[model samples]
Target chain A: MSSFFLFVLTTLTVLMLVYLYRVVRGPTAFDRVLGLNGISTKAIVLLVVIGTTFDRVDMFVDISTGYALLNLVGALAIAKFLEERGEERQ
Target chain B: MTFEFPLLVLLIMTAAGAIVVKDLISAVFILGSYSFALALVWALLGAVDVAFVEAVVGAGLATVFFLLTLFRMAEKDTQIRRPPVPWIAFVALPLLAILLLYGAGDLPAFGDPLSPASTHISPEYLENSVEQTRTPNTVTAVLMDYRALDTLVETIVIFTAGIACALILRRGT
Candidate 1:
């Protein structure tokens, strides 16, 4: 509620935008992956804040947890799959 | 004016960023972030039950699946290119969002006490569901029981997504 929190949130949005730009414009495969991972971690915090704002703490918490799991698993799977392919050709 | 604006702004920003990004991996991550932001917004709005579901499925499992597909997709060729023009997604998305927002105008106000959500069957479920179903949250009871058939179908859908992903990856291998 305080201006300080607002400032922090605003700063996050700005940072997120910067990252998005990289993901969109990056010329390589890995760079985009890195950018996306960064964005996802930031999102966890954002979700809780939204829940608090709306007084939907109970529902949002569960959703946040699920989202966290999805990001983690999805990242690892992609990483593993890519690694395996690279190894096979070599 | 307070928390909701911050939350909504975050969600839209992430959503826009996800679609506009060209790098598939980055786009996936943005999607995850978008999901997380949406979950947080859900929690803040007193939809803890919904938040819990979204957090687990959308943020957790969905991200994992996306990464899996991305990894499987990486081939001998390493170059990833933009689709010549991503400006289109940016322009078109806002228009879609506005149209959706207009549709949303018919919906009830956020957390409106007198809304159907607070009245109708919800109140009854809230009051007696704990004792009747041995569940602390009526929402869970409703999801698990009252809507048992639909939930079963949804579970099947999740399973199908996993299977389909595996099948697709297997083919490339």
Candidate 2:
């Protein structure tokens, strides 16, 4: 089970790298934001997987919960900022 | 341990991307990714509490604050011109990296049970934390009980900073 979790972790990290490439090379700011959001989602899952590896899911769950809430708030704040600035959706 | 290298590479890449990006918004987003990668690195190193703080402050609040600052700036100011590579950076960066690597070489291996910290007060804290503080989490007991005043002062500092920000933003608008 632990090895399986490690495998999953490797795959997620690879996917995260791909998203990071999009963030760096994307043509538009929106693409960068999308990539960041994708990375945050993956990070939350990564936290849980790490907790599983540590055999301390309960402890890490609390942190991941706080992380998810804050991630949402941050994304919403950015979206509102962009909308208010009237950035073109490209 | 297998995932650790890739995550560290991700951290380096995100940091470099943040620096190289010309758009301020892209830089801010890349910084957010950097924070997430750093938090993961902290977790991988068995520093769950530190990871939590990094996730909240670095990835969350810091990103929001950067965006707020960008929002207040003129749009034209957000697209920075690429500056010429500084000769000083070429000289200083390699020297700094070498110095840091030299320092790191003397540090104990990760999770070394016989390391100074592990051999010293850590064992005492681990053994007695639950009995004294009724907290299963030793890190929590240490932070909230053994070093309560330090934590309280940190909280107060953050609260004060929040109030100051509110005042400044209010005055601006």
Candidate 3:
């Protein structure tokens, strides 16, 4: 079971590399923001997996819940900034 | 160990890309990705408490702060340029990297039972944490109970940072 979780973790890390490509060569800020969002979502899952592996799912779940909220805050903040930036440009 | 090496490399790559990217917004987003990768690495290292903190502050608050800074700066100021390669940076960076790598070689292997950290205070903390603090999570117990003063001081420092940022950002033409 741990090995299966470890496999999932490895797969997620590889997916992060794909997201990294989007961040590095993104054509626009929006693309980078989306990539960041994807990475954060994956990280939340990874946190859960880590907790399960350690047999501390309840504790890790609390952390991940906070993480999800913060992720939302970060994404909203960036979106707001870009919206303001666009207004300024116009 | 097998998991750690690749994650570390990814962290380095994302951090480097964050600095190297041309656009400020893209750089900020990439920096978030870098933080996320680092949090994963910390979780894998069996430091879930640190990992949680990193996820919140590194991936969350720090990215927002970076974006806010970018937005506040004038448009021209945000255009990060690839400056003429500084001779000092070139020479210094490689030396620093080599020094760090050499240092890593001397550190105890990952999760080694005889490592200094595992053999020292860790056992005492683990064995007595529940009895002392009645908290299942020793990390929390240590921070909030055993070392409450330290946590208080850190909270004050973070409060100060928030105030400083607000003051600086509020000052304007």
Against the native chain B, each candidate's TM-score is 0.74, 0.91, 0.84
**Pairs clashing within candidate 2:** none
lDDT of 2 by residue, A1-90 (tens): 778988999999999999999999989778888998899889889889988898899988887898889888988888888887775434
| CA lDDT, candidate 2, residue B102 | 100
* lDDT per residue (tens digit) for residues A2-22 in model 1: 565566666666666676666
Per-residue alpha-carbon lDDT of candidate 1 for residues B1-173, written as tens digits (9 for 90 to 100) = 46457567767877887766645666666676676667656665555667666666776667676666556555432235655667888899899999999999999987687998788887888888888889766667998877889999998998998798789767975
Fnat for each predicted structure, in order: 0.59, 0.85, 0.79
Please give, for residues B38-110, the per-residue lDDT of candidate 3 as tens digits.
8788777766678877878888888888888778778788778775986899899999999999999999986
Worst 10 residues of 1 chain A by lDDT: A47-56
For every candidate structure, what is the RMSD over all alpha carbons to the true structure, in angstroms?
A: 4.9, 2.0, 2.3
Runs in model 2 deviating more than 4 A are A87-90
Greater lDDT among 2 and 3 belongs to 2
Candidate 3 chain B weakest ten by summed lDDT: B1-10
- Model 3 alpha-carbon drift over 4 Å, by segment: B86-95, B171-173
Models sorted by DockQ, best on top: 2, 3, 1
Error of 1 at A71 (Å): 4.7
| DockQ of each model vs. true complex | 0.41, 0.80, 0.74
For candidate 1, give the docking quality class from DockQ.
Answer: acceptable
